[model samples]
Target: FWESLLMQLLLFRESLLIHLLLFRESLLIKLLLFWESLLMQLLLFRESLLIHLLLFRESLLIQILLFRENLLMQLLFFRESLLTQLLLFRESLLTQLLLFRESLLIQLLLFRESLLIQLLLFWESLLIQLLLFRE
Candidate 1:
């Protein structure tokens, strides 16, 4: 009977040692899995941050392009308006020059008519004076 009890005690000790080893192995595996999950989460977070940064940069570039386009449109409008004003100024100058030319032509005609009248009066006076001298 004592030998049987000794054998049973040794078997229980061996089984306890085996159970302890398995528990230790399972605990190590669980810790390693937890660490791996944490590492994957960190990598995913970093990737998301990079994506957000790229999107922000793209949006900023688009805003700059839009501002430049608006500026170009304004400059174009300004140039068109300036051209129209210049054309109007040119037309007004031409009209003034034509008016000046017409006035000068009318003045020249009046001067010629006055000179002819004076010549006719001088001739009539000379004839009368000659006739009086003859009488």
Candidate 2:
């Protein structure tokens, strides 16, 4: 009976050692899988950041092009407005010159009519005097 008890105790100790070794190996495997998952997450995050930066750069370029186009349109409008103003000014000047010419012509005609009336009066008086002296 004493020998049988000793053998039983030795077998239990060996089985306990085997169980501990298997538990340690399982824990190590769990840690390795966690590390791999963390590395994959980091790589995915870096890739997303790079994609976002490229999209932002493209959007900025488009905005700059639109701003330049708007500026060019404004300049074209300004040039057209300036040309219109110049044309209006030229027309006004021409109209003023034509009015002045008409007024000057009217003044000269009035003066010529007065001179002709005086000449006609002088001729009539000379004829009457000559007729009386002959009678």
Best by lDDT: 1
TM-score of 2: 0.55
Question: Residue by residue across 59-117, what tens digits does model 1's lDDT show?
Answer: 99999999999999999999999999999999999999999999998888888888888
lDDT by residue for model 2 (21-121), tens: 88888888888899989989998999999999999999999999999999999999999999999999999999999999888888888777877777777
For all candidates in order, the CA lDDT equals 0.94, 0.88
Worst 10 residues of 2 by lDDT: 111-120
Question: Which residue pairs in candidate 2 have backbone atoms (N, alpha carbon, C) closer than 3 angstroms, thus clashing?
Answer: none
Most accurate candidate by TM-score: 1
Query: Each candidate: how many clashes?
Result: 0, 0
> How much is the lDDT of residue 8 in candidate 1?
93
Candidate 1 stretches greater than 4 Å from native: 1-24, 123-135
